[model samples]
Target chain A: MSAINGQSTNGSTAAPGTPRTGGEVVCDAMLAAGVDVIFGMPGGASLPFYDSLYHYQDRIRHVLIRHEQAAGFAANGYARATGKVGVATSTSGPGATNMVTCMANDIMDSVGVVYITGQVARPAIGSDAFQEADVTGISIPITKHSYLVMDVDDLPRVMSEAFHLASTGRPGPVHVDIPKDVFLETTTETAPDQVNLRGYRPSKVGNARMVRKAAEVINAAERPIIMAGHGIDISGAADELMQLATRGSIPVVSTLHGVGTFPETHPLSFGMLGMHGLAYANFSMRQTDCIIGLGTRFDDRAVGKEDEFGPGAKVVHIDIDPAEIGKVLETDVPIVGDLKLTLQKLLPLIESRDRTPWLDQMNGWRRDHPSLKIPDSPDSVLPQEVVRAIYDISGGEARVIADVGQNQMWASQHFWYERPRMFFSAGGLGPMGYALPAAMGVKLADEKQDVWCVTGDGGLLINIQEFNTLAAEGINVKVAVLNNAHLGMIRQWQEFFYEGRYMGAFLDNPDFAKVAQAFGLHGVGTSSRDEMHEAIAMAHEYDGPVVLDLHVDRVENVYPMIVPGTGVNSVIEDPR
Target chain B: MNGTETHTLVATVADHPGVLTRVASLFRRRGFNIASLAVGHSEEPGYSRMTIAVEGSAEEVKQCEKQLYKLVEVVSVRNLTGAPAVTRELAMIKVRVTSNERPGLAEITDIFRGEIVDVSKTSMIVQMTGAQSKIDRFLDVITEYPIEEISRTGVIAIARDDVGPRNGRARG
Candidate 1:
């Protein structure tokens, strides 16, 4: 029961001496964990902790951010590139409130981040004290879990618990709110307690019964379709999904988040499904008798007009979050557990069925309406062309993270990912500033793994401050921004819905190359299609962050555009 | 910031002394004035109900909820509206206008569906029970005349019979 970091005097039999402050213990624990960087902004409530941090400058590095929200993003990026837990600190009230979205983003994307915030002093907690806030209450729903540290002696355990919570289970953001007085007061409970996270192990294997049931369902069904989502990526079960689809001759369709889960070139692969989904893919979703939803919640965008989603299909929804089961479309069989484990368990239950006819039908649909198209000339590159070039260079196995909007659509429609877990995107909320930070998170999980961040100019700019975070972390993450210089999706809607009265759609250009250069990273711009291959190879060659701002054709809207309230088959390929 | 609008927020929190302070302090720090605060044991024990009528926009209301979520004791919070729920408010208004004024106390009582809880030679205390809008409208029509002390119960609501679940589960 001795102190782990030697910063506290708790539980010691020594003379009645005043104990060290909670902030000292926390700083020691952070140092013991080999943490080198913390991204945050300072405010009144957190002054004492910041003072403690000042003493640990030699061992730890702190990155000050203009906004606390960006601090969270920066920490996330650092964590993503190094596989270490990213850390963020902010004061209570507005500062803490600013971190909710970033924390929620981490939780949703499965990024490991330890977030610490300061609360008002205990005595003045509810007395309308200046700068005081109830940090623990505001973060519950957005975090994996949170703690309010009342006792200064409990600081070691609380900090330790926060780290464990952030790195363990499915990996998410964990928050610890420290009262100002607690951070400043001394404590004598020096014995460090072992962290016990009861019943929170993230086993890579699925429940045996559920896995067997899923396999049996897949083997028995003559015409089955796979609805892969982000969970497949988290579980690293993309390979399993691809093999099952290929061997069983099953067609695979992805929700927006599940974009690169299956290869675009696979015979049985349909494109992205639901609103703004490819026409044939949505049609296939409606026509298929058996739909297997993996890791994706049957969200509004995925299950367009829920009542008519899978008209007569036997749906099997597999996910880690139990709340999501039966959340949207009820499944004939529901498997609530880790996707990778479930798929591994499913291997035995599957028996090959005759899927030649299904494959043929899928091929026929493909032949009739090819989703992937490569640009002809060399001067201008389209989004699909850029994705195609990447696919050709990396083959079909490298993992890709696509940002929101048109670029996401293009990547979903163009990338030929031979394995599952290869595509990552913000599917549930369709959050705009998702890809770059998420890519950083993904890269941190596996550094050697080739990770590509496919983003639009608009989405990229939202969190572009992270570019410096990437450089400082020294993680060589590849970024390809589809620089259309417009809020392309909104402009597309205005073009179609409001007779091209483009209001607030245009954006002034930023010399992205200069921005990248300022971050001490390689930045290249390309309008010529021929230079794309060279640019991609050059990016991979660099040892740190690289941004390839590809100038693309703006008027070229993402195809198979289906108007809302209409069926899946209603689509316009060339809207112009 | 002038002519600030008041809002009604109903919250469920672990019944504790400091919770009220925590809630009030949040509003105070934000420069928001809590016009009226009413708290009592709710439908469930161990959990207390607080009806806080505030003044802000829809965005500000959401921001306040976000701030409230950061508090450990606040389990859930919501803004129940008139369209979907049964909204009820209790107000006791004392008017200084004479009983003999034009369209006086008799007409005001008849229109507000209120009783004169208290009667004096100069003024009458009108007890009105209805939705927030009704109470606001009643007050608006009577503002031209002198008014003394006014106390409102704030707004408390539950889902209408047909709209909410009969069973325990909440379905989307």
Candidate 2:
């Protein structure tokens, strides 16, 4: 490695014992990692570090969120939207604990996000001092790696290491819990320019032998299906995926997280497949001769009824993490490395071939049972129609986010994204109330990009408090609420499986327009289809954040659904 | 497996704080029923060797190896399931008997290559070290007599002297 300018490559240009506060060292490390923004909230234990952040205001900006959980989700959104390591910070105790769900969510999705948390003084660690919590202990299971900073000198190394591990192989969240006293303590030691951990290096290059075998399998596959995942986006390999797909004439189906990794409008693209997947997509899974899973874990939801999944399909799984290679499915070829590099190497080995018969079969499924589209009627509005209208009005270019549940499925089914990083949702943990805060993070990461948050009434209420954060931050994201009077997904299930026994599914939604008004933002509530279009347009035209509450049909279920405990092919095209 | 068969696992780990916690936590999280575990300094300066006895299915054992390798502190792990290995255990048994049965106890100890380390009017303590099965058989015979108590160290194993390290990449 060569020095950038006149800087020495030997590292540590600062005097050996120059005394600087640990907080300063941490801030210095963050700047070295190129962190421009940090999402967090200050409290008793983390106040010292927050104060240090004030001094670094010229170099880094801190965005204060209402809740620590949203801070985490926003960081997650930042990471996912920008393909950078997102970061969140909070004080000790409840502040640290509140970020748990988001940490777990990132871990499951393999999103790289760093979380810095404050702890009680070292001496007060186990004594239950005020605002003290076992943050590192609690986070060990949810993070790729966790650290409890013991020495002030170790802060710089820990920060650099956290960023390295979080952004490297098999990217996931990492937490660094610093004691309050450490931040106040000063040391003169200059931070190192690079980190060298003997035991922590991650291998990024794929094995030539495995890639060769995978290529051979790909060439031989007659009815091969290219299944992509979030890894494509994480590795910035959407173009590589398209290269292979177009080169080989292979059909593509995505896991939920892989939705926009490949353009849905492509001739070879089959949209998302699995539970609640297109009927044709599920049929392709059963009929394919080869299953090429790229950066996907073959999650249970993605491979419904595992016992009957891919009976004859030869499975080829490629991921940066070796742990996920064959953890779920019996893979014939397993290649471990960064997806983009591996795909780049493997693309040359691929042979251009035609699979007209397979394409014909999938085309038949696409035309026979298509994704639900909005009805042309001006007086009727459904959740599916709301998503479709937004898709139409945005020209499929706005960065789209959806909260979990009915609105999520509706958006995923209707919206056609043309590029990677254009769609964001809670795919792994599927946390509700994720859209509002996550969208804010996305908008912060790319202020010029238009962000649209498509959420449901139930999902919105979970983190409704974040609307204030949006208005306060002056983020101009569009919030489109697909307001139905019930937890629509659960209600749909009860109607289909439980004979319409609506227990604990009904929701008494407040006047969302008034709630948006209270937050000092423009709000429009409309139940008719024409009003829905007008409201979306008005919200888009508004200079600041606007909420459009769309009262959709009360009991519309997502179509092409795969009932639980059934094969992926056993999809219900339409529900009564 | 009736879920009671014994298997041996050898792992090399970085000699750092909380490494044992991470390795131990992994086993517990994976529902691996560990029968015995022993950790000691290894030949390398900054690494330790751990010998663990586990009873689980083949898949679980494979998973145990894979999961262990996933931990940064764990250098490598190998399961010595069927390969020839040297297994040993140490035990101390205290037996209660009269003077008449004392001679019989001494003879039993000699037959099993054990020794009476402690003796009293009511009891005698026998110390023995041997293969796990040998110790089990020895216990089966001694328990017929009136035994006050017994304690046994769990099994520890090493690969046969002829076998070199299976994979050299893990030898860091």
Candidate 3:
């Protein structure tokens, strides 16, 4: 039989009436590989793949994004929120190029997303043909693995491998670049259900000997602390981590992305630890005798100027990735394994102890550097006040998706999360414009779930276009915009570091409410404390997408600030 | 070559279409120059060994080792620069020749274990395979006359297991 799928056919008959082109096989394989949704945009090179999606609409839901970047971010968000592998699709050239940042960010945060992009046909690949690009070269540095499928026969194997590499071991983004002809050609090969990658084995269970040693250290030290990270949520070890933390009288300090891994409302919680961390949390880290780092890479932002971050503390670092074992802080005992499995074995060996003195000392720091209170400023509303209002309105029931910059720090510093996977953000890459689409993706997981996107004007503008996606899909995600009339974080840095030279630090004013309204969302703008409260309440009661613009103080900086180049303990509290 | 000497890197990698590109891309990404590289089959089936001569500082080489190990298909890696080893490269030199120079050329070829594979009235092709230094010396002698062209396979080496960490042990 002859075919007209932009290439000569080989008469592949995968099913009745289906000629079984590579594109159809890819879509079929994805469905078989357990993909339920795909975020993508249509383009010339990706026509074949898009056409294949038409036949599988009942099996797969494709979220059409306005921009390819948002598609990738949405896929990443979906993967992070739900523990399933997410897929993003785009055409060749600029469409693929747009996904670079999301790919880079996903790898940094260890987000598992498989990106499928169309490529120029094989014959015209290097001729600088229209919509052509070197997608493999562009994605190699950012992706865990990338492929350029030159032949149609390699599609099934490549698809299987891409999904496997993306969702296995240290999970991150993987890319597959398929030529237009390959997607148009017919193939009969099947994607394998089992993978046999000898060189890619990741040690998932901790060494029993190291777990024993870690237990001994925890038992001997009177002021041992558990610093948990996002890996706890990824590996579904929150329950096990809580068990270990409760088994010992250990205080738990959460890394930024690990906000809800352990309930912030728990008694043993020391809140978050890091640069802009709670002052008491940083103090607990400084005063601790032993730091048991669980599933964290010990990023610089998480533990500023490591020399004093955990002074006089012996660190027992546990992680699944071997490369992250001693990549940063000096670890006395390294246990490399899945956090769930490691803690499961280690919990039994730990002995309970009373550490009243350590808890008392941490309480004293809390009294000294108290959590932010809504300031009595009549002229400008404090950003924390907005977070407090959102907390009250949501009753701590919504999953908060905080954007980078000032809004992220404010949400982390003020809002409370009571369950695991309740907070998601671009913690490692700190990308702006993440919260809006990420919140949309999170909402897609459960349509009835309350999801909030807390972003500043600077970040919200970066992905303001995503409002269309929210409105089009009828996703009722609540948005809170902290409008400061400046790039708040950079302005704060300039205020502290550059002798107040605010060049390129100011953001021209935009009524975010108006922009949101233009995108078919209910918009509310407020300046006073009472108005902010009413606006948040209105947003909560709204039936669809609601954008609340809170005009906040432009000069206010996130406090408990660790001055750059200063020790982590040398934090600057607000003017007392 | 950042003012550093060349060092040989021996790696056992999976034999496939994308494996070579991965190794090459890694070297490029890590900011190192592969002065010479020869990849061929290894003793183990479904795997290949690569002998790459790279130029970088000791610290850079250490970083490159970690980066290379991160590649999924890379099995083992060894730095055999200072270790006791044998290195070889094969070269075919087509040189302009005269009947008068035949005796001298024959004597030089004998010393270098070379053979005159192809000869014509005006030119001759001498095939020589030996240590890199030996090939350099032979080329120096041949270049004294008008040379037509020279083709060479990059240097490939195997470490003498008697020298260091034996029994299949390699540093990461």
- Which sequence of candidate numbers ranks them by TM-score, best first? 2, 3, 1
Top candidate by TM-score: 2
lDDT per residue for candidate 1 within A1-576, as digits (tens), equals 222222232222224344667777777667655567787888888989999899878877776665677677656655644556788899988888888888878876666788889888888887878876666666666676677788887777667767765764456788888888888988765444355433233344556777777777777787788998867655668788877776777888887767666766666667788777766677676678888998887777667676566677888888776546675776878876777767767755677667888777766776776545453544566778888777777776567888888888887767766655567665554677777766765666567788888999999888787787678776567999899889899899899889999999887989887789888878998887767778988876666789998888876687777766665656666432
Model 2 segments beyond 4 Å from truth? A1-17, A190-193, A374-379, B1-6, B91-110, B114-126, B145-153, B161-172
Tens digit of lDDT per residue, candidate 1, span B5-39?
66667788878545776777678765666767778
lDDT of 1 at B124: 77
Two-chain DockQ for each candidate model: 0.04, 0.41, 0.33
Which is superior by lDDT, 1 or 3?
A: 3
Candidate 2 positional error at A393, Å: 1.5
Order by lDDT, highest first: 2, 3, 1
> TM-score for all predictions?
0.68, 0.93, 0.87
**Model 2's TM-score against the true structure:** 0.93
TM-score of chain A of each: 0.81, 0.96, 0.95
The better-scoring model by DockQ among 1 and 3 is 3
Model 2, A107-151: lDDT tens digits are: 988888999899998999999899888887788768887888889
